[model samples]
Target chain A: MRKYLLPFLFLFLFVFESIFVQYLPTEMFGSDRITVPRFLIISILFLTVFSSRKYGIIYGIIFGLLFDIVYTGVIGIYLFSFPIFAYLMSKLMRILQTNIVMVSLASLLLIVLLEIGVYEINVVINQTDLSFADFASLRLLPTVVLNSAFIIIASYPLKRHFEKFMASVSD
Target chain B: MPQFFLNKRLIILLVSIIVLVALIGFSLREREKVTWPEQFLKDMTGFVQNALSGPTNYIAGFIENVQDLQNTYSENQELKPRLDKLASLEAEVQRLKKDNAELRDIVGKEDALSQYEPIQATVIGRNPDRYHENLIINRGENDGIQADMAVITANGLIGKVKNAQSFTSTVQLLSSMDPTNRISAAIQAEDNKKVFGLIEGYDKDKKLLMMTKIPYDAEVKEGQNVISSGLGGVFPEGLIIGKVVEVENAEYGLTQTAYLETGADLYDINHVMVAKITSMSAEIQEELQSTLEEEEEEE
Candidate 1:
């Protein structure tokens, strides 16, 4: 029961933020469309801390594929970017096991880089005029701040659960 | 853990990626033609989406009906005494008439225009996320819509039919913020000189209808009319693009900013027109010439 609690709760919260929280106080922040939100990056980071390395990568890939299918995009964007994030987090695992701050910083760096890479490739190669204005300031800064905070605050309980899981499996 | 499961997952992933790539390449190859399987998928998706949207549509329709009934009920009560007078007013239809030939010509033009074959559709779904402006209409391959079919209305242009499945089609509206929406049109005036422009959507702040490449010498006024250039093979000449409300020249030179406003109210539109262009002779030649010039300039 406790093991499923974190994934379950985070899933609900992410969905709520994805669907609803982004629309509040419509007078100021409302717009026509949003690019892929950075919540996905934060989700991947949390899962890396709690789940197995292989499991984390698999989940990210599956999530990316789902994102591609549900949204009208180039179909392989999330598919490509997500696996890279998974691999990086897995590599980072050895160096930073107990530190929440390191995970937050790493995830934020990857997300910002990922946005620039995707936007540039689409604009240059495909000639898709996806606007990068929202991405640079209001969207990126707020997303990094909010997501890093969530990941840092949520890491302790997740770390404990993973330790217990490792113990049970080893025994 | 054994490696068998990992091997299986790898195989599945590789196969899926291959399939996705193949489909993309396939679509790119035949960008102009409508495939049968894609048509079927569109129809089936529309059927499912329409089934899902039935309840919401019913509620909205029901609310509208109640309001209409309330208005009619009061109007009927008030008009009871005037009904006898109105009946006499209608009798002049046969007696008091103008030039018969002129009236017939007036009626004949729109009658021919309205003779277009159309499949009625309901918008079953929109892009679930707030990121893209796309709508899925319930009419698809089964409804006779093919890829590139013009989706329009009695008044003006709405969009084009992109992917038509069996019973549903994904309509790419003219006002879509996507940069690909380069509508070919001309200014409707004495000159009717050739013109082209791009239409982009904004949910707020004067949903824009932006035109490009109009020469500075072109005598364009703020209230001057814009129409489909007919130079493009896709749209017929003189479909009302919009009334040009403003124009400005930039320091960059050569091209003036033609701030156009479209006639189509996408937010209120419930129906559209899709024209299947048959003869591509004159229009195609003109399109080819203009496009070549534009490409050369880019080069």
Candidate 2:
């Protein structure tokens, strides 16, 4: 039962982010489109922090492919970006003492990198028409704010879960 | 020492990049149908989306209903005059319909949209990518949904299906700025002149559809209603798209561009009706006219 918790949580986050976040009132955003939730990726980053970095890379690939197959028109954008960001975050964590503040800052920095990475790839393929300035002000800023709020709220509980999982694995 | 110089991690990185490029190249072909693996995953996720959306939507609806009750009295007062006007217009519309039918019979014309069949579906999910405008709905190929069928709510046209799986479909909203999704639209002038244009793309940030190719001399204005002209045979005739909110001169042409505010609330859609045209437009129109002429000759 314990073995299933992480994957189940990731799946639950995916479904909720896709379906429930849209229910948020547009008035809150002052526009129709809301920021895309990065909760699933954020949860994977948590795994990298507490349980194991390897698990983060593995889950990122599996779930990222599922996201690509289900939602995106193309197949490889999220598939590669997710695991790369996860690995990068875990590597950065090694230099700094891991705490809610440090992890939150690292996650924010990594997410920004991921956004820019996706945008550059999209531009190369001529899939996006948005200018960099507009993309930054409109999408990246709000997304970072929303995901930061999520990290602040979930950090402690997720940290505890990851530590437990790590301890069990060692035993 | 020489073997140790070649890192396993570097090789893995190189291999993943190649795999990534290959996957992108493969998926860029624009296939008519999703492959089996994609179909299977979409179906499974669709099931989960539907299962979870049901109870949550119910709870959300309940909250909205409670809020609506608070506004009911004022809303009723505001709607009373419109309700009276609507009743009178409904009767007038019925009379006009009968008159139009008689005129059509004499002229050997058929209903402009008789080829369409509409299927109702519930919206289950939105595109996880904020930049793209796609909605996932509960109906798919199993319910006879096909690519390019127009999806509309009670108010007006919202989008068309881009992909149809066995149990779910993806609707590319009119707000999608893809160059390939142009819709043939026309403005019904107050003087009864029909001016045509193409809804070419959308401005996502501004939440407006960009229509082009209107003749410069055409009498276009803000607040004019735009509807599908059905010139392309892809969209059926007279589907309400939106109302013109602005008109501007073309960047470098003899044409004009009109920006339309879509009537359908793209932010808060729940249910939609997908319209499938059963017959080819030109063939159906010709058949109807020929039969009507034959009957008249017999008379």
Best by lDDT: 2
lDDT of 2 at B149: 86
Give the share of true interchain contacts found in each model.
0.04, 0.59
Candidate 1: segments with Cα more than 4 A from true spot = A1-70, A89-114, A129-134, A138-171, B1-30, B33-133, B152-158, B175-181, B190-207, B213-217, B229-233, B236-240, B249-257, B264-299
Model 2, range A35-146, lDDT digits (tens) per residue? 7688888888888877888999999999899888777768999999889888998899999888888988888888888888888888777777888988888778878888
What is candidate 2's TM-score for chain A? 0.92
Error of 1 at A116 (Å): 3.3
Candidate 2: which docking quality band? medium
Model 2 agreement with the true structure over B121-222: per-residue lDDT tens digits: 988888777556788999999999999888989899999999999999999988876778889899988888899999999876666899999999998988
Indicate the residue-level lDDT of B276 in model 2: 86
Model 2 reaches what TM-score against the true structure? 0.91
Supply the DockQ value of model 2.
0.60
Find the candidate with the highest DockQ and give its number. Answer: 2
